[model samples]
Target: MPATPVADPFDALDPVARRATPRVRIAVGAAVVLFIAAVAIAALVSSAATGGGAQGTIVAGGGAPATDLGVAAASDGGASGSPRVATPPLLVHVLGAVTRPGLVELAAGARVVDAVAAAGGFTAEADPAGVNLARPVVDGEQLMVLAVGQAPPPATGGAGASSGATADGTVHLNTADVAALDTLPRIGPALAQRIIDWREANGPFTSIDQLLEVAGIGDTVFSGLADKVAP
Candidate 1:
């Protein structure tokens, strides 16, 4: 029997082709890296051209506009750089059963009720008479309304003060007049006259303590009048 000859391993392969496996793998890897780099570059270019953010910056719920990073005008800072404007002033007066009744400055066009509201509103003893809560207030005007069953405010002199006082030895300075000022235990017509004369010399009193400045009125007299008067 004759034996068959085996083919040589080296003889079956081309010499040049044997070296191509490493080069082929390296070329494929490079192609993949280049494809990834090309996609990244395209994305960057698209974002720059559209001026939107990389992830997209379209605002929801009616907000500000999103500008592209590419536009010069959008990035340059908008039309006006100044802040908001301020409003004007208003002035009104309140007089009646309130904590404080006097000229009050407020924003212009403020209502009469607003002035009353500022003066701490009507007091518990305030007279609802002649008072219209819904009425609009005008500047530099006066509002006078007392509470129900409440006497009208004392006149701005000694008589009003004595009338406003009670058996408890207290006076309602808001309503006191010249005659009322004489009603004080120690006050007589002469001293009362002095108080009225002093009040005429000065404008509306700012503090009851200022009463001491009147002739025949000293610390003793003023101390008695202190709790009995209001500015």
Candidate 2:
């Protein structure tokens, strides 16, 4: 046969080249498939990284509710919850007419009665009624009890300054005799006598409020008596 006329080099295919053409096409197709797969994988990895970062941002802080700035919860009370510090026990100065008239160590919120109990309770001469047993005690405060017929030290303006009546004409609640007490408003001879009787039975009057404890004295009578006396 005459030599074949060839326009391109590839067109002049011998038996060996013709046999290799299918393999070359397959290699090129494989290279293209690998390139597309790598691009898709790269996009997926980038998307995953961005999504993870967004999730982390939300977890850090967003859409959180307001609070009392944790003030109410910071302590069972202020300076109370801090483990490094502790509140000291109350040092109540329980003096006069208690069995042990001195400072008594007590817990917070202790009452006068508790202090009296801690100080070995009231002496036989101690006016338990005069001590305001129901009143809460204070730290570093002076609580003085009285015996029968005793008067507390004078208050400002000479109130309760005398055994009978002060210059301001206020009757001393504890030391006033029946005649002096009778001078008060609504106090007749019988009521005046009763005032003295109550002081003898109870301890000395620590507060004029004690007038209500007398058998014949009521709120109406005590109201009339309130401004006329001091203790």
Candidate 3:
């Protein structure tokens, strides 16, 4: 009617409503942008964890590569690949005259003699008497050898030689070197050497009676050694 009520463009839009519309649009755009960014970040993280690549790249802590534990030493001093030696089951028993007696296990084909040596060999007085040094040892076999110069130890197990009920025992004069002769009660190194020198100079004694010819041996001394001496 009045020139169609010439409307003002500014008046056509309400100032308060216009301002509110822009704010709403800005907030909705921001929310959509945040959602898209979040989706992109999540996709990237998932791909990294599962080892994604053109083909399939290995990633540490992901489904990646593995190492062989049985590797031999490499040029860098790390293992690459190899095998280990397998040990055999071996057992042996050592007894008699050894410093320690017991059962021991060793590598297969180990010798009995080796087992005895492992147990500490023979004691100072061990009787090499009946022992066959060259005999091959078997598992669980018992070795018994006597000590030097002593009577066979009684089966009863005392380490000392047993004294005879009468007159003790006789000493072997022929085998009695100075060291052996020293076992006599009062004899010492000097006397022992003297006796050994005498025996060496003369032939083997024919009888126990010939001992008197040695220096320092007289009737009374001979009587004392009568039961103790042997030819």
Candidate 4:
């Protein structure tokens, strides 16, 4: 046709444009990879800066650890687990011939000696022979210590000679001790002591019939003791 369009040698030799396109695509891909790497590195650094996943951590008053504080609390609770029990006290009435007389509180199972001590012991005129200090005391019982050289209390009735004598005719209500008084008909140690207590509280009996005035004594008791008792 017009000499085959006169073949262009320059066009056939030029591969510069095609090579340049491949280089540009490669550069863009490398840039994208660098940006992703930078973002990943920054995330990792932030995670390391702060406490990430640790658990069960405590901060005490002085920044003590959780384990230390927990152990201390457990120790305290264990030490106070059981409480102590207290014992009950005894109330006693101590009167007559003591430095300080009235009610006194003492430990349980206390003896008369303990009661006397609680009442400030005995006074100068206290006659220890009148009481059994070694004996144990009961809650509501009264204790009385007689004065030294004190005579038996007077009887309620007018004075009379000894009446209800024992087999030896020597027993007397005012002068008899607990043992001698216990020998009286229907009279026991307790009643004898009661009689002594009554005599000490009131005066000695003036007549055998005055025994009726003492506690635990009635007409029958008086009749039994009528011939044996005296003022």
State the displacement of the C-alpha of residue 55, model 4, in Å, after optimal TM-score superposition: 35
User: Which of the two candidates, 1 or 4, achieves a greater TM-score against the reference?
Assistant: 1
lDDT per residue for candidate 3 within 59-139, as digits (tens), equals: 354532333222323432442335545765655555566898877665656654576677888888775533545444444
Ranking by lDDT: 2, 4, 1, 3
Report each candidate's C-alpha RMSD, comma-separated, in the order given: 15.4, 11.5, 18.5, 17.8
Stretches off by above 4 angstroms in model 1 are 1-85, 147-231
Where does candidate 3 clash, by residue pair?
Answer: 71-80, 71-81, 72-81, 126-147, 127-146, 127-147
The Cα local distance difference test for each model comes to: 0.61, 0.69, 0.58, 0.69
Which candidate comes out best when scored by lDDT? 2
Tell me each candidate's TM-score: 0.34, 0.34, 0.28, 0.34
- Evaluation by lDDT, superior candidate among 2 and 3: 2
In candidate 2 the C-alpha lDDT for residue 44 amounts to 89
Q: What TM-score quantifies how close candidate 3 is to the native fold?
A: 0.28
Which scores better on lDDT, 3 or 4? 4
What clash count does candidate 3 reach?
6
lDDT, candidate 1, 145-169, per-residue tens: 4556654443444433234455554
